[model samples]
Target: MTKTLALIAAAVLALPLAATAQSSTDAKPAAKAAAKPAAKPAPKKKPQVTRRAAKAVEEVTPIDTSTDVTLNEADLAVAGRVHTGKIQCELGADVTVTADESKPGYFTVSTKGAKYRMHPVESRTGAIRLEDPRAGAMWLQLGNKSMLMNQKQGLRLADDCQAPAQVAMSAELKLNPPKSLFEGADAPTSGPVKK
Candidate 1:
């Protein structure tokens, strides 16, 4: 039994040596296969594409200045009332309004980097309103002040803008301080009151 056990141990140790020798021989064959150049693949036929002649494209007129807004007499009247030249506003900012000689009832409103072609728009409040529909900007001229607003941005670009006339009007309003609509409404009417 001891002799058998000794033989079994010897066979187990020899098994590892055999596996190492087999792996070395297998590696040499794999290395030789990698050293040999691989066969090149045949070129593939590409799909054919048909070419068409280019078609002439019509010139596209830009929509910014192309808008032909015909102003009525009322709108023109409002335009005439629009204060021209540079108007000072709050925060030391100024806006310039210039009437276009070529196009009546149209004015260019510019401040710093922005410039817009605006036209008078009728307002229910009796204020002179100029609008640039393309740029979504509006200039509102009131009795005592004017303002530039960006409708798209939902904020006023310039507020408390005053021209020469507006400055005087503003001072007058401060001095007189127009009476509110409800000032005398609460008081009894001059007519005989029913007891």
Candidate 2:
């Protein structure tokens, strides 16, 4: 019985060594096959730019300041408000919105002389939206004549008020207004003045 058990243990130990020798012989052929250099990939071709396409690129000009830029009301209504709206918020605060004529994508929202510049952003739904990222506020245009203003602190306002056209500043006043700080004062002297 002892002799038989010893033979079984020796056979079990020898089995792993035989399998390892067989795997090593099998791996040599695979390693020799992998040692050969792989075939090189074909070089890529560059796209040709034709002269007409180059001329098409050169013919593109920047926005010309010489031409007058006008804002269409219908497009403005869909994207942003063309005119300003005076809103009374639920927090009992009065807010004023001034649409930028030169840049139709921006608006100025003012409250008690404090102004905030807001940019138009794509809304989740079909509503027109203006967002003030600094203040974490959003203004949604509900209809052609009404707007809903929302703040992060849960303050909301429904505004339908519109200011009269006369309240708008004239083009002359808006373009070249007098300087506020040094209207009457001369330029500061460079050094101490002589007696």
The digit string of per-residue lDDT tens for model 1 on 1-195 reads 335545544554465588689989899787888878865654644422111000000001011333578989988888989999999999999999999999999999999888989998765435677888788787878777787877666656888899999999888977987554225324434887545
Clashing pairs in 2: none
Q: Model 2, 1-195: lDDT tens per residue?
A: 335545544554465588689889899786877878755644644433322222222122111222233435644565544346775544456678887787876788776635666665543334445666666555554332334344444444544432343223323445755354225444545887555
Give candidate 2's whole-model lDDT: 0.50
As a whole number from 0 to 100, the lDDT of residue 39 in candidate 2 is: 57
Error of 2 at 83 (Å): 4.4
Clashes of 1: 0
Clashes of each: 0, 0
lDDT score of residue 84 within candidate 2: 63
TM-score of 2: 0.34
